[model samples]
Target: MDFFNSALGKNITFVRPEYFIITGFVGIPNMKYYYIFLFFVYFVSVLGNGAVMALIFLDHNLRTPKYIAVFNLAFVDLLGNTVLVPKVLDIFLFNHPFISYNDCLTFLFFCYTCLCMQSLNLVALSYDRLIAIIFPLHYQVKVTHRSMLTLIASFWAFVVTVNLIIAGLLTRLSFCKSVVINSYFCDHGQIYRLACNDNTPNLVFGRFLIFLILWLPMVFIFLSYSYIVYTLSKIATFHERVKAFKTCTAHLSLVAIYFIPIVITFTMSANIHPNARIINLSLTSIFPPMLNPIIYVLQTQEIKVSLRKILKTRMQTKVMAKKVIIM
Candidate 1:
């Protein structure tokens, strides 16, 4: 209380509650089944993303600028879902929807940070593809391991700082109106709207975040692909053009999976029921992390090759151990 008062202004009095009730899935029919589905999705997401991260760590061939972005994407997806799903289950599934004020702010910080990073990681991957496709000859020079690492590190710094500001701003608002948050998680928008005092700062920043996290990244990706398409048009052979486009299929699929649902949900929000909107938003959050690794494994030849190589090596080691035991 003193901290928030000090941080905001000495004259201002903040009316914060001990806890806030989450009512995101309340009144929805058969919500237990939805929680069960989330459990399944979380399980698969852990396995798939873990496998991708493990493969990247174990294989030297994946130690390139491209896989650096891929590794970061997998990491963000794993973390984003990890921060979101378990708490969601605890709150709704286990019948514990009351989160303390400080805990809720912390939850908002980590979830929003990871969420922002997921989109920016996609931007990193898009940048990798843009350079690889557009400037094949200078790809290595332009997209170095050091450079990619720096770019990813910069993204982390930026996203973490932004979300910290968001969380900090939330501390200033006095939630005298209501303490029940209306989203699946401790969503920033939901929390701010509950404030009795002026939330213009929060509201303005929220809009800025929408542009920064969603629309800006989407625009960058779209432009990157457009450039890639333009560059591919210059290629003389149809086979080469097809091959080049094929390299992008996995990334394209990931972009679609990550953005399209979000776009639809937000655009159609007015027409959609609140319960339906909650379910759609939840699915949008959980689905990409589960699907990203699968799409990469199936579409990206390099990941497939790495998986087979690792499996073959493990099998050969087992066979050799059996031979030694027999002798």
Candidate 2:
């Protein structure tokens, strides 16, 4: 807030949310235990995603369109969680939820960016799988690294433009004296609801975005998988069918893990404690990023092989050092 005070005193004061109190997870009992659990989650998420990215980065064999998308997803997972977890933890532990308006918007921007990035990357991954399965011979030509990168760049531009429009509307809202964001972070809906002026525009647009962001990517994914299933049906051999199913196992698990809680939590939040619900929503947000790499590690033999190679190299290096010491 002080930094904002120093930076934008008179020039930039057009209906700003000065300070907001974050009020999710703070109401929970045993603050210490919650902190510990969150720390564990944060550590695991970083490690798991970082390891996957490292494997993809270092090994040329893993550098395909599929793994490239995986790398991007892992990156956003780490990014999204890092932005919120540490800050939210600070709020939870120290009772310091009062955040500057600028900072809140910053957090919101990154949150939406990460969400869109993950969703789009998943859609890309699904398309890659779809093409590979549906057009085995021409898949290589269709889904090249250069082509996927172009799609990624386009996706980045689109999501940023959309989110910027949302944020632009958010800045236009008028707030009352009591400017407190009642969530783990500055939720877009919560802040909009606090506006003193007519917020129907905000509400309508927000709802539309929810439908757009959630449903459209999922529809594409479903269509791709439906095509894959149709293609699989033409295959006669049982072993071949099993192999094809194995390829989709990781992605299907990740999609289920991500989507189920979103459907359950948002729809059912009204029936439960609002703070509890927001906390649960927060959990859902971070949990997928954490779980994604774990799912890959468990389901993907290539990833396991990479892990084994990494471990073996480290062990051999250690052995060489020990032998030197003995000499």
The TM-score values for the models, in the order shown, are 0.96, 0.91
Q: Candidate 2 at 99: error in angstroms?
A: 0.4
For residues 272-303, could you state the per-residue lDDT of candidate 1 as single tens digits? 89889988988998999999999999999999
lDDT of 2 by residue, 86-141 (tens): 98888878778788888888888888888878888888888888888888899889
Q: List the residue pairs that clash in candidate 2.
A: none
In model 2, which range of ten residues has the least summed lDDT?
5-14
For model 1, the local distance difference test gives: 0.93
Instruction: Report lDDT (Cα) of residue 238, candidate 1.
Output: 97
Which segments of candidate 1 are over 4 A away from where they belong?
1-13
Off by over 4 Å in 2: 1-15, 324-327
257, model 2: CA deviation in Å?
Answer: 1.0
